[model samples]
Target: MRKFLASIAVSLLITGCTFPGVHKIDIPQGNVVTQEMVDQLKPGMTRNQVRYIMGTPLVTDTFSPDRWDYIYSQQKGGEERTQKNLSLFFSDNSLQRISGDYRPGGAAQ
Candidate 1:
């Protein structure tokens, strides 16, 4: 009985000392827009022109037909996640304004 208990305790101790490794999968979501693509955008560009330049937007609202949102986010393992957002507003089916994390010509407005 003593030997059996000792064996059990040793097994338990060994198992307790072992830890399962954690593997974090990279998570990426939304459209991936680059500075060059953003640089191509300009006021008065048509909706199709913007789409051709920046690809499809990540978020589009039915209620807000005049506004389009481009969002990008990614996370890798234990590293800090990064996100970018670009919003375009249209008036009469033409690009009127741009806003969000990225700005054109270093200007926010």
Candidate 2:
């Protein structure tokens, strides 16, 4: 009876013990683009030039060659931490329009 109790206790302890693989992944946080970066862009800038100012676009329209979309999104649980979307349209190898938080209102472009 004592041996059976000891075996049961050992089994219980082994079952209760956590093995491994339990972990918490940390999400990185930061801003994607700055207002200064967008202000530096000019109307005559080419596709490569715009790419140099901003990082690689998040969404490159497969169906459209003249539109470039840059989106920065961060979500934690059920709350949106940050969501910024920037769209740049190009025509004839020149920047046509810039729309987003990074675009400057009074800047000559």
lDDT of 1 by residue, 1-109 (tens): 9999999999988876354665767998899887778888899999999999998888899999899999899998756999989999999999999999887765433
lDDT, candidate 2, 1-109, per-residue tens: 9999999999978866353543434353443776677878888789899999887787888899799887776665434467777889999989889887567544555
lDDT of 2 at 32: 74
Q: Which residue pairs in candidate 1 collide?
A: none
For candidate 2, the TM-score is: 0.61
Let me know the TM-score candidate 1 reaches against the reference structure: 0.73
Q: Candidate 1: which stretches are off by over 4 Å?
A: 1-23, 106-109
**Superposition error at 102 for model 2 (Å):** 2.6
- Candidate whose lDDT is highest: 1
lDDT value, residue 38 of candidate 2 = 80
Worst 10 residues of 2 by lDDT: 22-31
